[model samples]
Target: MAKTLDELLTVTAPVDLPSYDSRATTGFDGKKADAEKQLTQLGEELSNLQEKLFAGGRSGASPTRVLVVLQGMDTSGKGGIIRHVAGLVDPQGLAITSFKKPTPEELEHDFLWRVESRLPQPGEIGVFDRSHYEDVLIGRVRQLATPAEIERRYGAINDFEKAFTDSGGILVKCFLHITKDDQKERLAARLDDPTKHWKFNPGDLDERMLWDDYQRAYALALERCSTDHAPWHLVPSGRKWYRNWAVATLLLEQLRALDLSWPQADYDVEAEKTRLAGM
Candidate 1:
């Protein structure tokens, strides 16, 4: 049997992330039609919650922001999740960054330097398509950095994420766990459809060759960096629809936990009404 999202979290939430299945759809028993309906509803609720978070300054406190970091292999639906789930929110309250190869300047500084400037402001939700973890994942798999350097980066990542949360940022890290066979199918589908031909990269196959190495790197990254403040979660992503739904649900869970409310109006309602009536 598949596990519920909550159940999956309970089992995978440990700092040392246990092995997880990538295709479990345990909690959602509904059909596709039902899932779509529920997704629409979730979209609405997400919008409302975002509005409250956006207007947080009206209540005279700095707004609590959230940063959702997504990591996975190519063809893992990171783009799809951003378009489907994060797209539902008001863009004014959202900031997104997709990290690519580092520039000469970026290479000169520490790994986190390029990441610092892209952080979401107060009352905003930030999403990283691929994040600092790349320094460890690709950095390890490709030997861009030595084993000692990779280990040091793990420590740096943990400290950075912890400080982010301590400074009123809520961090949600998700590893879109997809199987090798599933990836091959998706890549083939991309090739099959002319519209998606632009999405296919010849370089992805190169990375695919080092799948086992990448997986080991990921396991180590998750285990070391999944801390109390910014824990990691594995979102089963073999199914595209389920991946979108699960990401949305996970975000909703975090937003709701903040118990955000509309900022109280500073002006007197009755006085404003009287003044407008007189005008």
Candidate 2:
């Protein structure tokens, strides 16, 4: 029997970040070209299911929605997944949010208040480039929040996610796994090319200085937050094509699990056809 992608990539055991290979294409034996072909093949199916989901939401027939939370170190290809994987579906059905630094208003409330506002509505597939986990990841590393406060956030985040899932949301949490060497090379490439200069941030290097701290933060987050309701998947992201294909495949699995069908016409179809012909 073939293993499911979820079974292959989902983080079931406690992770030791340093030991995991960043370039591994686990469960996929294909080359880059093959992965790209598979990603393209996923398009029609993704689009069709997305249309059904959108229709269900428009007609208020279903509350099912999907949320793809992407968290990774810089240059781990979060934007690439959104552009490739989420792009396979209709743009109308996707609500993509790239969480940035908190605005003054956002700072006034509890950390989750801003996140709650950005969740995907019925029938939509929501993608978060960087998400609430930032509060725990960067927040912990930078000591932006008190140590005790950071500890409290783990339970808070778990409760918050449980509530979202209870309300008919499907959460696909992914942590794009990459290595320090990967970041160094990518950043160097960015600096080497003037056109790519905009992508580079000196502050990113500042964060890189504390790479060990960030790793500890991430390991803790993954272990503490990988609950039954919303387990995180560790996606090896050094290979961009494999990362894109893997995420697309994971999404396809979730959409298929919904078992959605084209919504039935609420009005009489034959009568409508007859009326249209007469007109």
lDDT of 1 by residue, 211-259 (tens): 8888888888887887778878788888888888888888888889899
**lDDT (CA) for every model shown?**
0.85, 0.92
What is the per-residue lDDT of model 2 for residues 1-279, given as tens digits with 9 covering 90 to 100?
Answer: 998888788786577998889899998987999988888888888888899999998788899899999999999999889888888888989999999999999999999999999999999999999999999999999999999999999999999999999998999999999999999999999999999999999999999999999999999999999999999999999989988988888888988999997777899999999999998
Q: Largest TM-score belongs to which candidate?
A: 2
Which regions of candidate 1 deviate over 4 angstroms? 1-7, 10-19, 57-60, 267-279
Candidate 1: Cα lDDT at 146: 81
Clashes of each: 1, 0
Q: What TM-score against the true fold does each predicted structure earn?
A: 0.91, 0.97
What clash pairs does model 1 have?
2-26
